[model samples]
Target: MESFPTELGVLTCLMLLAASLWIPYIVGVNTAPAGSLPADAPDGFIRIPNPALHRPWVQRAWRAHLNLLEQGIPFAILVLLVDRVDGFTALTYWTAIAFFWLRVAHAIGYITGFARLPLRPLIFLGGWLCCLIMGYAVFAARMV
Candidate 1:
């Protein structure tokens, strides 16, 4: 009956919802004219031309979602480790918040073409740093 950090729970839900956010774009791209698919297309296939390959915004959203998943795995592990060892410290809590917000920002930026604003990379790096901080906190807690 051990309690998990609230931030971790919230972030987990956000990550799952973020993954689903790409569905609309995927559906839009895959919804095609009747008989327009290539002859090679499998019968009853839902997707025709790969959305990411054909649409820039869809590509951006797909990549952003993938990036979130990539980062989320490590973040989840570290968050759990930290919770098991030391519960949530001020540093861990704030870092988790920062990471979650940055991820949201990154997704929005990518989807709306704001990622080209020169701040997107910085936002991504910020999220990475948050993960690094959480990792260090977990390590430090374990050493005590």
Candidate 2:
């Protein structure tokens, strides 16, 4: 059976990739009006230049996406480990959801150039904590 966390994680990655086009699309739309641009006009109507366009912001976005993608492996591992121990529970769902959503927040932060704030670090630490919990859970299960 497919793992829910891993599946959602894939969707998350797709969201990141799809989101990248939005800026460019906005740029294109900005060139148009009422959903259509004049034939002679160049595309630039809806697109605002992202501060995230810089090397640092772009790298941040990519790194965050990769980080989330890396987490996908562990997501599967968690489920596999869970099966070897207890079945899925509400807490498991919450934890995984929190992790996935935080990475998404990180993506948003990076894309919007908000990753520099304390909020970014907070969200990051949340993801790390979720991973740590899963690690502890696996180890604790083996011990039990």
Candidate 3:
């Protein structure tokens, strides 16, 4: 197996983590009792009257996955640009790792209903900081 850079490996792991968030959502939908579905649900489709109101955790899982996508796009672009333009530095590597861990925390907190009040936002900010740091590193490298 070819050894990949630590930064790249972290990025790959983040991607997988983002994908993993969907598991809870899919399972939640499939496992819900048929009787709980809306009476007007299509013959072959499972439909709830109001998923966000009735299935908050499922909504949380789905939103957590979406949040990852929203943040991951920019993070991925920055990491790739940094790697291609100036190579990964210690800052980039550590930032990537921090971002991954922060996201993990966010996802767990969100899905498990532990993301109360400031906690979730704090975790999100931490990940955003990591992205900012990495983005700055790329800009700084270009200035050198």
Clash number by candidate, in order:
0, 9, 0
Model 3 residue 51 CA deviation in Å: 4.0
What lDDT score goes with residue 23 in model 1?
74
| Each model's lDDT | 0.75, 0.58, 0.82
Model 3 CA lDDT for position 97: 90
| lDDT sort, best first | 3, 1, 2
- Residues 29-129, candidate 3: write the lDDT tens digits: 77877577667666655454345633678778888888899888789888998887765788888899989898888989988889888999999888889
> Which segments of model 1 are wrong by more than 4 Å?
1-4, 31-49
> Which of candidates 2 and 3 reaches a greater TM-score?
3
TM-score for each candidate, following the candidate numbering: 0.79, 0.54, 0.89
Per residue, candidate 2 scores C-alpha lDDT tens digits across 29-85 of 343336343344445522444324334544455455565556545665665676567
* TM-score of candidate 3 against the unseen true structure: 0.89
**Candidates ranked by TM-score:** 3, 1, 2
Model 1, 1-144: lDDT tens digits are 977677677568766866686774675456555665555766655554365334577667667777788887788788888877875788888888888888888888877788875798899889889889988998888777
